[model samples]
Target chain A: MTHTVLVTGVSRHIGARVASVLAADPEIGRVIGVDTAPPPSLSSDGGVPLGRTEFVRVDPRGPDIAKVISAADVDTVVHMSLVSAPPRSGGRALMKEQNVIGTMQLLGACQRSATVRRLVVRSTTAVYGSSPRDPAVFTEDAEPAEPPAHGYAKDACEVEGYVRGFTRRRRDVTVTTLRFANFMGPGVDSPLTRYFTQPVLPTALGFDPRLQFVHEDDAVEVLRRTATEDHPGTFNVAGDGVLLLSQCARRAGLVTVPVPSSAFQLMGELARGAGLVDFSPEQLRLMRHGRVVDTTALAAALGRRPAFSTATAFDDFLRARDIAGGLPAALMDLLTRAVAR
Target chain B: MSDVDRRVAELLALLRRRVTGEYEVDEFGFDPELTDKVLLELVRPLYRDWFRVETTGMEHVPADSGALVVANHSGTIPLDGLMLQVALHDHHPARRALRLLGADLVYRLPLLGHLARKSGHTLACREDADRLLRKGELVGVFPEGFKGVGKPFSERYRLQRFGRGGFVASAIRAQTPIVPCAIVGAEEIYPKIGDLRLLARALGLPYLPVTPLFPWLGPLGAVPLPSKWVIGFGEPVRTDEFDPADADDPMVVFHLTDQIREIIQQQLNELRLRRGHAFPPFF
Candidate 1:
C-alpha cells in the first residue's frame, strides 16, 4: 500500500531531511511538508513537483494548522516542529506554546483525518536531563530528568503526552517517540560546532567530558522507521560511538586549553545570565559527567547500522564548509597576507 | 558484642561453608580458591582503602527469619548487589547469606551461570523467591530490575517499574517482612550514557549498555570505581499485617509499592545530602 506522510517542521534541518527521505521512498505515494519557515529552494530528487509535497506556512499553535494538515490527505503524521533556536525573547514560552498547542492542533487534525494511521514525534535526549557520572548509559525506562533551562525538551515530552494519549482513543494510530542525542552532520552549526571551530577549545576542569552524537542521516533513518514501522513506545536514538569533548575538538583540528572547574562554572553562569545559552546550573553540573544512551531499541526497530560515524560526521561538516583539507582558501589567503605584512 | 556483629560472623561462616561445599568445582579447571581469594584479597583491599562502605538499620533485617530484601538496583553492572552482599555478611545482625534474585540472562551464560550459582544468585523468578523465602533464607531482589540498573545516565536515580508487586506477593505468601534498602553511589559507579537496544537483543542481553567505556575500553569500562556506598535499610513493610485478601487488590499493592518507593527515594535523598557529592573521589 502506498503511504502518504505529513511531516511538520520540514523546513528545519532534520525535518527537511526526513521529508526528503520519505518522499524518495518508493513505498510512499505522497508526502506533505508543513513548516512555518519559508520553503527551501532544493527540489526533491524524485522530480515530483515541490508543490505536490504541499508546504504549509502556518503556525502550529494557530487553528489553521489543523485545516491545512487535514487537507493534505496524510496517512501518517510526523510531528517534528519546534522553536529550536537558542532562546530569543520569550523563546521558552514560544517553545512551550508551539510544542503543546501545536501538537494538540496537529493531533486534533490527525484525529479528524480518516486516513491517518500513525504518529511519530521527535523528542530530544535533553528530556533525560544531564547525565550523572554514575551509570553513564541512559535507558528508555529511566525517570526523565527535571525540566532544564532549555524548555524545548520538557515541552517536547509534553507534546509526546498528547500524542500518546491520543493513542488511547485511536487504536489504529501507533505513536512512537524518539529521544535523539546530539545530532551532527553536514550543515550542522550548533554551539558544539562553534566549540569545535574555535582555534583553541576550552576543556572543562582539565577533563573533557564525553559526548555522544548521531549522524543526521542515521537520525533521518530512525525517523523514517518510526513513521512507517509499527513499533510503539519511546526509544533513545544516538550514535554507536562516544568520544571525549577534547577528542572531538582535536579531531576538528583545534588545540585544547585546560580550564579550571571554577572558571568553567563561572563562564557557564555568566552565559546563562546573559541569555546566551539555555543551560541551567543543574545542566551545567551534569555537563561535567558524560552521558551514554542505550540505543538498543532504536537499532532493533530500525534493523540497520547508523549511517555515519563521529569522524565521518565531522568530516562531512568540514567538507560542507569547504575546509576539508585545511583552512578555507579565503582564511588561508588572509593568513598569508597578514604574514606578508 | 552487637547483634549485627554476631550475625555477620554467622553469615560469613555460612557463606564459607556453602562456598566450600556447593561452590567447589573443577569442571572448567576453575580455581577452588578464586572466590575466597577475591572475597579476601581483591574486594577487601578496595573495601578498606578506596572508600568507606556503610550500612544502617541492620536490625531492620530480621536476624533469624526469611525476609525479602528489596533494594534499588544501580551500578550499570551488578557491582552494587555484590557490595551489598559483602556489607550484609560483614555487618548485618544475623549475618545470613543473601541469595540474589538475578535476571534470567545471568543463568543463561555457561561460566557466568556457574559463577552466579556459586555466588548464590538464582533466576529472579517468583518460584525461586517463594522457595527461598519458605526455606527461611534472605532473598535479595532489586524490584526496579534492569530498568534501574540500565537507566540512562541522564535519568540516574530515577526508579523503574517495580515488577507488578511480585516481591510483595512472595513476601506476603511467606509472611516475610519486605526490607526496603536504598543504595546510593552505585548509579555513579558505572554511568550508562547510552543504550544500543539492537546490540543488546542481538547479544541476547536485556539492554546493551554503552557505559563510559565498555567495548572500546574493554574490561576497564566494566571495572566500576569504588564509590563510597551507603546502603540504608528502611523499616520493613510488614506483609503479615496486611489482609491476605488485600494481597490481590490493586490499591493494596499500589500503596505498599508507593510506601516502599518513598522510603527508597527518601533514603536516597538523605544519602545524597550526607555525601554532598555525586560520587566519592577515587584515590
Candidate 2:
C-alpha cells in the first residue's frame, strides 16, 4: 500500500527538496506540500523531471491546516514549516503564534486523523544554546541552555515539547525531532551564504569560531530517513566535519574584514531588532562557541553516512554558484543565473 | 561600631585586602587567562556597583585533597559557581582550585569546549567525576542540575530535584566528603523574568532565559546586578563513613540526599533571615 505524506513549508528551500525526495520514493505514493507561499516553478533541468508533488498554499498556522491534511488523507506528517530567519520587530510574537499554535493545531489534526501515524518535526541545533565546545561533541540528550536571545527558537522548542508530550498520550503516534546544524546548499540564503557572496566578509575581530555545515542533499537525506525510519526522540543531525567561517569564506574566494566583536555584536542586535537577521544573542553565543554536535545517534538512527564533507559541500556550493574559478567565475555565474532567471 | 560589627567589618576589610593584594597575586594569580579575565572583568564591576560579597566556611574546603564539594545549584545562570570559585581560591588559606562538574550542556559548545576544559569543568559523568576525584582535585557538583539553576525567580531559593542522589554515589565511590554550600546572591543576579523553552532548544541552549533587562538592553542589560553575595559552607557529609557497597541502596542514597538538601535549605533560610532582604542587597 502506498503511504500518503504531508510536508509543511514545501514551497521553498529545504522543504521543497524534502518534498522532491519523498515524492521520488516508491513507498511514498503522494506528497502534499504545505506552505504559506506560492509553490516554486518546477521544471526539468537537463531533461529530467524532478518528481510528482502537489502544492497546497495554506498557512500551517491556520486552523484550516488540519482540515486540509485530513482531506488529503496524509498518513505521515513531516513538519518542516518554520520562519527560519530571525524575528522582526514583532517577528518573535508572530513566530510564537505560528510555530506554537500551528504545531498544536497540527498535532490536533494528527490526533483526529486516523491516517496520520508518524510525525517528524524539523528542529534546529539552535535548540542547544551556546556552551563551551567539547571535543566529545553533544549528543541528543545534551540539555539546552537558556539562550539570552532567539526567542523564536524557544517557542519552536515548546512545539517539540507538545509533540513529544502528545506521543506519550497517544501510544500509536511515533514522533521524531531532528535538530539540524547549519545547512548550506543550493537555494539556501543564510548568513554564511551572504558572507560568501559578499565582496568583503565581516568577521568578529580576533575570533574565528569553528562552524559545522551540512550540505542540503545530506540534510534532505537525513530528513528522508527520519520520515521513513521508526526512530523516536530527538537527534542532532549534523555534517561529517567542521570548518571555520573564515575558512569557508576564504575557500569561496571572498575577502574578509575583521570587525570588532563588540561592533559585530551590536550590529547583530540591531539587525535582529530591525528584522534583518534571524539569529538571537543565544544563537550568536552558539555560533561563537562553534557547535560540533555528535552525529553518533543520528548516524545510528539513519544507518548511513552523510555524503558531503565541509570541503566538498563548499566546493559544490561554489560550483552551483559558478564561482569555482574565483572572482571572475563568481561574477560571470551571478550574471548568467540572473539573466537565466 | 560594636565589637562584633567592628570585627566582622575588620575581617571583611582584611579579606578584601588579601583578595586585592596578596591573595589575588599568589593564589589565583593575575593570569591573563580568559576565564580569570571574564570572572574579574564581568564580576568586579558588579562587585563594586552592587555587591559587597562575603565568603565564610573557607576551612571546610579540603586544603589539598580530592574532595567533592556538592552544593545546591541555583541562580539563573551559574554566576554563583564563578563567584564561589573566585572566593574559594582567593579567600581559602590553601587557595585550592575548584574543578566544577558542569552539566552536559556546558561541554557542548564549539569554542566553549576549550574554555570549559581549561577552566576545569568536566561533564557531570560519573567517570569524569571519578577521574577528577582520584587525581586529588576538588570537584564541585550541583546535584540540582538545570532544575535548580533554571528555577523561576519567585521560587528562587527553593531547591529542585537533585537527580536521585548521584552526587552522593559519586562522593562515596570516590571516598570524598560532600560539602553543602549555600550561595546567597545568585538568584537575584539575573532574576529570570521569563523562560521560553522552545526558543532555548532552537538556539541549542538549556533555557531561553530572559533577564528583566537583557536583549532589550543588549550587552548593558547583560550586566548582572551586584547582589551582595554570601557564600557559607556547611559541615561535610563524610562519604568514607558510608559502606561503599551500599551505593546502590535507595534508602541509603535517599537519606543522604535528604540530609544534604536539609542542610542547604537551612543555610538558605539562615542567610535569608540574617540578610533581612527579599532580595540580596546591592551595594
Q: Name the top TM-score candidate.
A: 2
CA lDDT for candidate 1: 0.69
- In order, what lDDT does every prediction score? 0.69, 0.71
TM for every model, in the order presented, reads 0.52, 0.55
Off-target runs (Cα >4 Å) in candidate 2 are: A43-50, A86-90, A133-136, A147-149, A271-279, A322-341, B1-283
Candidate 2 vs. true structure, TM-score: 0.55
Point out where model 1 deviates above 4 Å.
Answer: A40-52, A86-90, A131-134, A144-150, A258-266, A272-286, A318-341, B1-283
Candidate 1 lDDT tens digits, A1-341 = 54678888887777877887887788888888877666666663212234456576888788886776566667788888865543465555676777788888888888887878888888877676653212235678766434444555567667766877888878887788888877787655455554455456556653434467788888888888788778788888887756555445544545566666678778777866776554455445445544557787877876877878545666677566554333333344454455445
DockQ of 2: 0.04
TM-score of chain A for the candidates in order shown: 0.82, 0.85
Per-candidate DockQ versus the true complex?
Answer: 0.02, 0.04
lDDT of 1 at B208: 78
B-chain TM-score of model 2? 0.81
User: For model 1, how does the per-residue alpha-carbon lDDT over B20-68 read when each residue is reduced to its tens digit?
Assistant: 2222222111223444445434565555555467778888888888998
